[model samples]
Each structure stands twice: as C-alpha cells, then as structure tokens.
Target: MELPRHYNENRLVLMVQEPTIIFSYWELSRGQWESLGDERFLVLRLYTTGSNRVSTVLKEVSLPPFTNDWYFRNVLPEHTYHAELGYYGPEGEFYPLLRSNKVVTPRTRPVEGMVRFLKVKTVILDTTNKDTAEEQGDSNAFWGGYSSMDLVHRS
Candidate 1:
C-alpha cells in the first residue's frame, strides 16, 4: 500500500484523544505554500475557545515549513479547541494560512451534585427475638435484636 505525499489541499484537522491532550494534522496545497513569503516564521498554533467564544492560543510551535502534525499536551478539560497554520509576523501580527475543525475536550471527572441511582435493601430487626438471636451466636445480635424483619401492615 502507498500513501500520496500530500492531500493536495490546504486544510487542517484537530481532534481530542482524551481529557488533557489534542492532536492536529494539516496539508498545504501548492498555492497555499507559494503564498507564504519569507517575511515571517511559520508556526502551528493550538487554541482554546473560552465560554465567551474567544479563541486564545494555548501553544505555538515553530514549524519547519513542511511539518504536517503536532500534539498539544496539558490542555484543560471541557475546552473548545482548534488549530491554525500561520506565520508570526514581525509587528505582532498573525497571518493565518489555514484553519482546522473545532472540537471540545471531554471532562475529566463526573459533574458535581449530579443525580445518581443505587440499589438498596431495607431490613427490619426484631427486638423481641433476642434470646433466639443469642442462641444462634450471630454477631448481628450485638444490638440485642435479631436481624430479621417483621412487617406490620397498616391496612
């Protein structure tokens, strides 16, 4: 089996592997590569979008111009993320060459105060059966009651 050198498209992809890490891959088409001048350094940037929908760069790695993939670690859980292939301009500017799909990281833990269901059994003790309970030598009789239920029907 053979794989083509590049996808021949200018696109990027970002995905979450678990709660704290994300991976990205990209391919720049011929035109996209030629469009980048030598004025700035190429970079792969990982961003996290906050609740206000503002994207903040989490990490930026210098690219070797032909680099295709990278991994971002120590990311915060439940954060929206995306990747951008761009140039770090001389005047504190970012020239985005291509953008990746957006995704949200999974939470690391269960939500607090969430409802949970558990199986339970109720047992009633018979205080009147203490002598029989003592004869059985069961530890449950320590409370001076048999570990048996006696239901009294209200009806």
Candidate 2:
C-alpha cells in the first residue's frame, strides 16, 4: 500500500507492544528496516486489553519504500479498545489515526468516526510471558515477536 503523502518526508516506526501475540506475513523495505534501531524502535506502540489478542497477516509478499500497509485481526470478548498508528521522528509524534469500540455486531471495515490524531509521547509494553521476549531476539523469524515502544511526543 502507498503511504500517506504526509509520511513521505517523515520517518515511520511500527511496534507490537501488546502481550503474547504473533505478527505474520509483513515485509519492510531496506530503508524502513534500517530506520528502526533499539532506542528508536520504541516509537511505534500498540496495546491490547487483558486476554485480548491482535494479529496481522500480510496480503502482499513484497513492499516498496514509503509504503504504509497494515492488515490486522483481533479476538476479544466484549470490550472496546484503541489501536494507535503513526510515525515518530525528531519533529514530533502522531496517533489515534484509527480507533475501534467493540460492538454487538462484528465489523469488516474500520468503523467511521473511529479515527483521530493525537500527539503522544512514551509508550509502554506489558507482556504476559517471558517466551515472548525470547522470540523477539530472533529478528529473522517469519513472525515477529512483541516489544514495547515509548514515544516522546513534542509540543
């Protein structure tokens, strides 16, 4: 997928800060891959509720530079939650680009009025198990593991 025009000049980072979950079928360009370092990787933060699960399946095998693509599925009992997506750089931070509240009926497309933007800083990842952290050590693994991303948003 093509990245939004605004993100072209900005740097993008993605992190899975939620507890025990797996992300599959996602690929990043050499540039995007290199943009993320240990300290900077904390810029992209996503969270989930107790016992909730989040999963991503890539539809495309390869992606080009300046591309923003996401395919996600969630399984939760009966609670609404927010999922934040955005880019973090020296300039500042952005988020709430998308949000969803659990309803009685299932949703196929993102619910309207569910998207917004917020300037945020410092994201935390609380995990349920140690194995999740161990798996994250193997970056080469097809399914990437979990990690925390703390964004420091500027005014």
Candidate 3:
C-alpha cells in the first residue's frame, strides 16, 4: 500500500523487528524539509506478533524537577491526552494497546540523547482473516494506520 501523502515527505520511519522496534529519525536538510511541506510532525511505525488487534493509546507526560538520572530511576504517572485509530477484530471486540518498555535512543549528533525516552508497543489484534495476513507479508507495503505516543517519562 502507498503511504499517505502526509507521510511521503522527509520523515522518520520506525520498523518493528523482533524484540525491539528500531526508529530511524531523518535529518532533513532545509531544502529537504521544505520540499516535503515542512510540517513539524513525528512518524511512528509499529509491528506486532500477529495475535490480537488492540486500540492505540496516546498519552502526554510531565516530569518533576529532577536530574536526568533521577528521572530515569523512578516511575512517573502519565496523563493520556489523545487516542485514535482503534482496532477491532472480526468479532468486533476492543483490545488494549500498551507501550513497550524498550525506548528509542536518538543517535543524530545535534539531537543525540535529546529525546528523553521512547516507548514502542506491539499492537495485538484478535482476528483470523487470511487477507490481513497477506497484506502484512508484503514488506514493501506501508500501513496507513498508526499509533501515536507523544511523550515518555519514567513510568
């Protein structure tokens, strides 16, 4: 499937491999960003173990005044702000999607370590459709639907 026009620009692509979801944050030059409409947006890609479909949860987070080490050492409460792109199986049951503990660490020079943390989750969907399985098999295809998580804290 072709990616949405909005995602066709100079954007980061997250690929869900096994055990870890790898994030490739693009370093768009001025010209590159301008050519792509220059929208300051983040893109996330998720892969699952093909079990059950789940609803995407979006959360906004805040950290107390603490050193970086302190922040990483404790679990913090997160405030959920938005959730969209809910998934349903053939039975039409609602499943819950969660953020995995593996965080993406930014590697770019200027933004290196700028991102405090990232949480990647495998959306489990409950279904038995063979067509869905086929669609997922095409590695070149892009799934339009995505889960969005805006922030990450200790907890």
Candidate 4:
C-alpha cells in the first residue's frame, strides 16, 4: 500500500520508543508551510516535566527546511516529555505552531538499581522496596546479594 507523504494538516505527535528515546513527527498545512518568512526558521522544542509538574525546555533543535520527523535520545526513564513545533519571530520571540501530546517513558529494570548496581559487585537493587529495606535493615534481603551477572546466569 502506498501512503501519501503528508496529509496537509497541522499536527504533531510524540511517541515513546522505549525507556530512553522518543520519536516525533509533524505535518504542516499548505498555509502553515508558507508562513515561514525569510528570517524565520523552524525549530522543535523538547520539554520535560519533573515531580513538581512544571515543564521546562530540555532541548531546542533547529530543523532543516521541510523536515517532518525527529528522534530524541538520552531521555531519563519514567520521565515525562512533550514537544512543540514552532518558529522564532524576527525579534527572537517564540511562536508555537503545534503542541504534541505528553508521554512518560517506561521505567527499566536497570535504572531501578543504577545507584546500587554500580556499587562494588554490580548488583542491581530496587531502591523503592519498602518491605525488604524494613526487615532488619541490613540491605541484603531483597535479592540475596545477587549481582546483575548472577541474575543473568540463573535466569
């Protein structure tokens, strides 16, 4: 089946490819495409929200002319992100054309143990385990001193 390049509609979409990357695509209507003046250029702004629910711009990427898709990398697991398609006005003011839906990256197994896993034995520990951390509090009950390699071999 053949698909048209674009639907000629102004739209933006953001999708999480995994726990650390995002894929985004956008389309501009004919009128929106012509709206870029001589001094204006296209740009995509990636925003991330923290626990406070406040959004901040993480990265601003300059897009080549007539581009449609972008890939964002190095995003933290379990983080919220969104994107905005816009252009800078002649005076350096931002005028957004479209806003994408918010997305949260899935938490991975390794991130749960990054702090503890990077320790002496490369053991991955779940920091949020309240039950194990409460029993005697010796920090050995959760996985029984299993390093990441041990888990790999056992499984």
Candidate 5:
C-alpha cells in the first residue's frame, strides 16, 4: 500500500506553543506548487487582537521545493494574532493565499504591589484679568468674574 500524494484538505494550521511562541503547518499539493512556478515565499503576518487595521509581517520563509512548516517565536503575550500564508514578490509585495484562525497568547499576572508612578502636572489660573483691567478699569467678564463654583454649578 502507498500513501496518497496529497491530503484532501489543503489548509494552514496554527497553534500556540507558549506565551511568546507559535507553530504553524501547511500542506500544498503538486498542482498548487506548480502554479507558483518558482519565487515562492511564505509570509506570516501578525495582528493585534480584534484589530485588522493593526498588523505587521512577523516572518517570511522561502519555500524550497517541498517545505511546509514553521515555528514562530518571541510573540507578545495577551494579544490575539493570526497567521497569513502568502507569496512574496518584488518591491515589498505579498499576496495572501490562505489565512489561519486567530490564536490568543496566554496572559501572565504581574507580581503584587508592582511599582507604579503617577505624574501630576500643575496649572495656574489667573483670577486677575490684565486684559479686562486694561480695557475696562473695573468691569468684570461675569457677574462674579467666572468663579470655580459657577463652573461646578453649570456642569
């Protein structure tokens, strides 16, 4: 008995190995490989969870003859990401052939009492209006010169 030349399903499969590592596998039939006709490159694109707009090419592996597996490492944690299998070409061009399902990396909790700093900025409000004083001597902009209590009441 001999094995089949290719499986029925030609698809890309991705899995998470660790908080910062991913593994991928794919299968391409002889007909599909011939269609590419050399200059075949497999590119993996990573996207931030829930956002199609935010993404970057994580890795690109040149397909030589019959290679179809890759291990992606050093990924960010607590983010949803997906892999795109595609062909790479001239002038930074890539055409995606297939896409894997989204995979979310595991989250690690931070230690208790983590050191965090809060920044406070100081702002000064000039109660003395030089422009009003110069223009109108003693005329105020509001009935009581726009007090903070007025702002609070308006809100």
Candidate 6:
C-alpha cells in the first residue's frame, strides 16, 4: 500500500498552562516541510488581542529543526494571545504556515471573596442517621453547616 502524495497537515493549537505561560503545537505537511529546502528553520509569532486589531506581532521565537511544539513564559495574565507558526527564509522573510486559536490566561489574583468562595468545599453527610440529634433536627439540611435557627431566618 502507498500513502497519498499530499496530506492535510495544516493545524495549529495554543494552550494556556499558567497566567504567564503558554504552549503551542503545529503540524506541517510533507510538501510544506520540504519546500523550505535549506531554509527549514521555523518561527513562532505571538500577537496580543489589542494588537490584533492592527495585525501586529508582539514577539517572535526561532524554533529548532523538526520542532513542532513550544512553551512560552513571561506572558501577561488575563490577556488574550495568539500564535503563528511559519518558516524562516534566508532573505529575512517568514512564510506563515498556520495560525492558532486565541487563548486567554487566567488572572493572577482573584477579586476579594472570590478566592474564598472558590475554596469552599461542600460535603454531603448522611442525614438519614436517626442516632444523631443534628440529623433529627432537619432532614432537608443543606450541604453547608446550617443550623435550624439559620434556616428559619433565611426563610
């Protein structure tokens, strides 16, 4: 069996690992990889959402041969970013191969009470235990440690 002469390998993906970190992955078809010839070097370009309005390049990275993935650090938090994978020619030109989806890094610090609410853990205790007085008090008790008096005032 013989493989097809041309394969559809145009794909680029971006992921956020942390507030200051991002990851990129790409694939190149056999033809696209070989067309570069001696200029087989690859590069990754980053663009901020704000800059995307004007189609600007925030940063550029030179990728090694056969490299299909990269980890970028020191990126700002709470900002949307995108990456472009391309080939670098000797004439100081970059031929774009694929563009990745936009990824937004999470904020480094959450607002007040936000962290507390997110950290709150809820546990469902078996309220059917007839031996416990607490369970006997309220069968419709919520997951939180809510007393009968608290429930009365809430209603």
Q: What lDDT score is found at residue 154 in candidate 5?
A: 79
Candidate 5 lDDT, tens digit per residue, 40-134? Answer: 66665655554566666555666555567778788887878777777767877888877888888888776464343343333333566444432
lDDT of 5: 0.69
All candidates: TM-score: 0.65, 0.21, 0.18, 0.68, 0.57, 0.62
Off by over 4 Å in 2: 1-46, 49-69, 91-155
| Candidate that scores best on lDDT | 4
What is the alpha-carbon lDDT for the whole of candidate 4? 0.84
What total of clashing residue pairs does each candidate reach?
0, 6, 7, 0, 0, 0
| Candidate 6 minimal-lDDT segment of 10 residues | 113-122
- The residue pairs that clash in candidate 6, if any, are none
- In candidate 6, stretches whose alpha carbon ends up further than 4 angstroms from where it belongs are 1-8, 113-155
Could you give candidate 3's per-residue lDDT for residues 32-145 as a string of tens digits?
A: 445435332322223222124443333222212221111121111221111111123447553322223323332323533444333333333336543543355645333443
Query: What is the full ranking by lDDT, best candidate first?
Result: 4, 1, 6, 5, 2, 3
- Indicate the residue-level lDDT of 133 in model 2: 30
Looking at candidate 4, what is the lDDT of residue 8? 89
What is the total number of backbone clashes in candidate 1?
0
How far is each candidate from the true structure, as Cα RMSD in Å? 16.6, 22.2, 21.9, 11.2, 17.1, 10.2
lDDT of 4 by residue, 36-142 (tens): 75666789999999999899999999999768999999989889999999988768899999999999999886555523243342233476654443453656534
lDDT of 1 by residue, 9-53 (tens): 988999898889898888888877777755556788888888898
**Lowest-sum lDDT 10-residue window in model 1:** 145-154
lDDT of each: 0.77, 0.36, 0.30, 0.84, 0.69, 0.76
Write the number of the candidate with greater lDDT, choosing between 1 and 4.
Answer: 4
Instruction: Give the per-residue Cα lDDT of candidate 4 at 28.
Output: 86
- By lDDT, the better pick of 2 and 4 is 4
True lDDT of residue 104, candidate 2: 24
For residue 95, model 4's alpha carbon misses the true position, in angstroms, by 0.9
Candidate order by decreasing TM-score: 4, 1, 6, 5, 2, 3
